[model samples]
Target chain A: MNLMMLLEMAADGFGDRVALGPSDGGLTYRDLYDSAGAASVRFRADGGSHVAMADLSSAALPVSLFGAAWAGLPFVPLNYRLTDDELAALASRISPAIIIVDPDSPDRLTGIDGIGLLSRRSLMDLVDGADPPEPEWDMTGEGTAIELFTSGTTGEPKAAVLRHRHLVSYVLGSVEFMGAHEDEAALVSVPPYHVAGIAAILSNVYAGRRVVQLPTFDAHDWVTLVRAESVTSAMVVPTMLTRIVEVLDAEGPDGPGLQTLRSLSYGGGRMPSPTIQRALELLPTTAFVNAYGLTETSSTVALLGPDEHREAMASADPVVRARLGSAGRPLPTIQVTIRDDIGDEVAVGQPGEIWVRGEQVSGEYRGSAPRLTADGWFPTHDGGWMDADGFLHVTGRIDDVIVKGGQNVSPGEIEEVLVCHPAVADAAAIGLPDRQWGERIIAAVVLHPGASASSDELRDAVRDRLRSNRTPDHVEFVGSLPYNDTGKLLRRVLRSDLAHLGDGSTG
Target chain B: MPSLKPGSRFTSSVCTTQVIVVKGAGEVDLRCGGAPMLAAGAAADGGLPAEGASGGTLMGKRYVDQDETVEVLCTKPGDGSLGIGDALLDLKEAKPLPASD
Candidate 1:
């Protein structure tokens, strides 16, 4: 039940296969296994209760992750993008930890108490110098494997705890052991702090797929690397996909010549319809997958797979075609239910909070009680509805649902209609205080270059598709929308930025 | 009888067979090589496998009983077959899910 078992199996099954870096000169499964074993000895000697990483994606990430598991310590990856004060606050909470950092910036957490700093290069050197110990990782399966800090847009960040059993179940339920072909390679551009990044490493390794790390994301670099490495698959956030679509479009009709990429999965935010549509048109050979999950869930709980994507795009029926925006069906290993505010199950095609129960669902956070109900369902706070055909459509966060004159308005519904317009490039709908109605809807619009659409035209677009109550009261044309690094829209930031548009009264 | 629970490991006394329980509970006659398997790392009494159960087991494959109540994943290969009492376990077919990270 230890994370080391996966590495041990990989080492035994495919010792000679490349597991990381380039195809010819990368570390093999055996090498990674030995390095993890050696790193565990160093972690144990350091007397740290936890192992933390403050750097980007690299060989050090997998080493530290497995090494901590081998040493029976929790692994925590801190957001390197946080300011010094914010980083210090988080570091203090996980004090008495060994933090891995970039060699160039070793002093990132200089003043933190009881924190041991080890450069990535030095850690690698330790791996190269020391001989690994015999296989002896704890096998209870109850030990914490990872502690991810949620991107707290509303308030302070909370550390989401993932135990070994939860993660191992996720990998086993979703992936087959040694299923990937020897030539398969996956390009990972997400940072180490994200849950997707962690999942990508574990799943790819178990499936025996070679990994190529991209420390920071850039669309042009991503396209070039895919070609150079002959990468067969990739996972990206919505923001990254949008930029890549732009890059591919700029290369003309044939696209960026990415014949090697067979599958491309996008998630971590609400992908604008126009972006996904253009992407499908440009990359005709690639299989598009829309994965949906939260940090609380180990990773993806549901996915809209390749065949469904092509079917949704080609179908003429609006009901089937609209599945292009749906999250598809839940995983066979998980159970999903849409429950109302009173804890009652909603009818099919009805909107409610998404509650899920599964072996991979670890709805526990540090210092907080488990969020699971008596029956074991974890209420996700995400607003969504399941269609009669079983496709799940996610509206934004439940907290962002706008209540206007006793009617509930989903910003995602309005934004979807607005983004369909040819002139609109990106759009976000937010609710502002209004004296007349309980709240007034405001649409923040980003238009394509040199393209223009009047507020009346945009409002009519929503009014035509949906009920008149869903139309925006006002439209604010802006240069761009605010999104976090992981592609989640900063609605709270938007609400505050556009606060002046509403009356000062709380009504 | 050996107790079986998910995540418990077992090894055969006659051959190199090793398995981790994926789905099974309570005590049962979990046998390999026509002999009762012992907990992992337990001493084995030297003897050859029985004539009927010497087919062999493959590494990384899952074996399940006829009623599909018990499932065990082979972590190590062996010269002996795995079974519950008289009925031999069949290799479980892979479901082949789409790759999603």
Candidate 2:
């Protein structure tokens, strides 16, 4: 019911083990438990409806998260990248909350009424000096554990509510208690606001894996930290992985390889195939996992494990080779179905909206009705299909599907073919409004550094690989495609900027 | 006796051993040290464990019946083995799942 149960087990099972920060001298499970208890005391005294953090990842992240859980308050991690007005608006919404602020940026959030501000340093100091709170914690499952603001790539950000039971079930179903070896440590660079960040903390703690913090992520710094700390595992967004592959390639053969890293999982956005293929070649020893999940499904609902990656990449069968691009299978705890427009189940290999049902799938947003159906299935709005062998291939968001001449074209399908071309480094396919066709497919192409490709060649490549209808009506080579901080391609931004082009073929 | 359900927490009547049900749902004799386990925070009936029931429990280890019908994860360790009726539960070696996060 309470996430404290998971923490309490960790504290009881491996109290002396380092749970967070630098592996050599980080907070032990006992230290984290005590700090959380101390944090609960401060949070209860603040009389807040929630505990909020506006800073990047640090020791303060876990303390506030567990502390809030212990105190029976919803933990809200707001995006620090938001503008001042946006931050203030979100702060106002979570009024009467203890907002953990960055010490360097005090002026940004000061004078906000009903918001209690605690500097990160002061919060850590409080934990260091204070007595631990009583062990008693609310065990009910109905209380909200974390309220995360969706990235709102499509529209206005909604607060996605994850109850304690949902998270507890997710951790219990996916992770084995005290499963991690003593020397194992995981590097976490994803910002605190990300669902991956929260999931990383909870799963690692329950597995007894030590956490190494990376407050700011640059590929160089991430690679350096991995070597310096002997980090064995890590989770990254697709953008981070692309930069990391570039960094490793620059390191050359003699440079320190990712020898210590046993597992590297990437998600939160679509990963260009070339990057993952290059990464697999660069670090053949490391296991690559393709985790596909949304903010609504706790974290990873489906993951492509390392074995599948190797098999798919090495297999000669076309179907097996295509599995490399698939998200693999749904988790044992999750049930997934591809549904047609009428909400009926689609045939195998047929693309439809991905609907998932499980205890971990919240499908609920604050101030909005739960999105789950009466039977409990949540329409993910992601367009994907199940292969003959049960592998799930996510094409793209349904909203991102380009409807042209009464036919639906998946931008991802075209983007995949474009990226496979040697001259292309990245590609995003979007629909542009057209008078003749309901929507015209326009491809935004980011060529490899110093590489060039003509629109005809790219168009021929798509036309050759897929059907003629799937070919890009117009191809615009660009320096870079727009992506959010988490690596989700800003398709709307691309649509707006290129809207003026208006089926450039006509012009 | 309280019907067992997943996520339900129970405390040993004779020891500090506490557990949460990871699997199981029905009217069944779930016991610790040959004594029925009490609901968490329930008033304990202080007494010594029955003979042959003091084999003990390990912290963080999962115990399951032979048929795997009932499974419990120990939150706290104690000198009293967990059981279903008269059958002592065996230690379940947890298969480590692939780290997805």
Candidate 3:
């Protein structure tokens, strides 16, 4: 069905509640509903095939999103961090579009053909002045709701298409209507372009939780906002959580100083063990969730709940404690299977590619055919395994696996062992071409300040934990590793940076 | 009897109750307040709910038939109860999940 149905039900169920911003003078559910209806008239009148936002998160976000759905057009949010040329290139791809920009940079998207520009200020003005039409939206459930461009680490970015039915199914299956209390508020720091950012908006609105926006992420400002707004929950990427934990640790450890934050969820990348362990120790009362999903999956298909976090931390058994690193189990509506390279289902505790099938999984992209198999399972390029207890341990992207002498070696396994060393702050393992072996494993490491570890010592750490073959051929200490804004390690960048090691003359 | 499928909306003739089908298919006699329901947006004749069918429907709640083959989410609350033929729909219990967003 139409995404407008969710907003309509929220408006009808609790029209008077604050849906966004500060509670005292925020936009009410009815106000958001009316603004969406009014904004739809303008979107339809613009004669654009799609509605696009090239700005950060704000009240304008919800208005444009629902308005696009009401007008029966797909909403596209482009990364504002891109260069002018990059931004214009993407805008040209989605021509015949209305791109909403910040008032300060209204000229960001200028000189593009078939593109109408609307400053965020003027959009708000229209929302305030226009009259709402009657409740009417397409209900076929097949219209495109969002087109998100995957962060192109390897090559050109691919536009992933999420239809109304896919997104609505995600919201309906995972979230309850009016489940949140009136006092509950969620702090969102991720940019509008991320899939989690879009999911946060729809899920929070349907749950009747007021949203507090943080346009840019800074650990200190995040802590201040939680205190100022009495925010009850929040979601963050692993990098943001690491910085927040450092900020809390610097304050000295009676507590994290965030009393009202009852739930904190982290995803988008793998969480380092030290960061999560320190966070659990610092904020004992807060519920921590580790959600795992991809842009094609419409957000979280699996999550590790709070109780499991505590149990894993307290349990002395290594098997039970290792659950801390697991992604827990799949949602009841979703089915997850680990399959070998030939598409055969692998046994339990065996590493293979992750395949999922669910109503929420779109697995479709623009300008390409659907990626789903004839049987409806989508092969996620991610490598992972399920433990005996059914906990999913995601190793890393299958493309990043190092093939050494006809054996598949997961970089994540080596990096995890290296990071366990007290001297190592961060680590990354990449495959470099070798004459003797098909590929050689090179470990790029960043050491803690004033702490030192010999290359042999670090190699031994991995060899002790895993097979000797998994140990890195060489350990190169560096200042830091490269990670994207969303915390995904840029392995492609790492490979290019250390290409000299593969040269025989250099050795 | 009207053809039923997911995403179809219906309104009660006797009261203000409205629902969107979340499950079910094929033709069946879907009733509300002891009267046959009409497609959403259709005009309704003003009348009270039947004596035994006035259990009332709550907004944002799911109602399921005995076999659970049919499920509908009430979008508008009213004095009428949802049912099929003479069997009344039961309120589906919620399975609480932790907030992941």
The per-prediction CA RMSD against the true structure, in angstroms, equals 1.6, 2.5, 1.9
Candidate 1 lDDT over A1-507, as tens digits, reads 777878888898898999999999898989999999999999999998899999999999999999998889999999999998898889999989999998988888997889999999999998974678988876667899999999888688999999988898888788888989999999999898999999999999889999999999999999999999999999999999989988888898854578999999988888888899988987789999999988789999999999999999999999899999999889888899999999899999999999999989999999999899887899999999999988999987999999999899999989988988999999999999999898999999999999998999999999999999999999999899888787789999999999998887798
> Candidates' DockQ values?
0.60, 0.54, 0.70
* Model 3 Cα lDDT, one tens digit per residue, A402-442: 98888999998898888889998899999998887878999
Point out where model 3 deviates above 4 Å.
A504-507, B66-68
Clashing pairs in 2: none
TM-score of chain A of 1: 0.99
lDDT of 2 by residue, B1-101 (tens): 75898778899999889998877898889999889999988987878678999989988788999999998888998888999889999998755567877
Give per-residue lDDT, candidate 1, residue A203: 94
DockQ, prediction 3 = 0.70
- Best by DockQ, which number? 3
Clashes of 2: 0
Candidate 1: which stretches are off by over 4 Å?
A254-256, B43-55, B66-69
Looking at every candidate separately, what fraction of the true A–B Cα contacts under 8 Å does it contain?
0.40, 0.50, 0.54
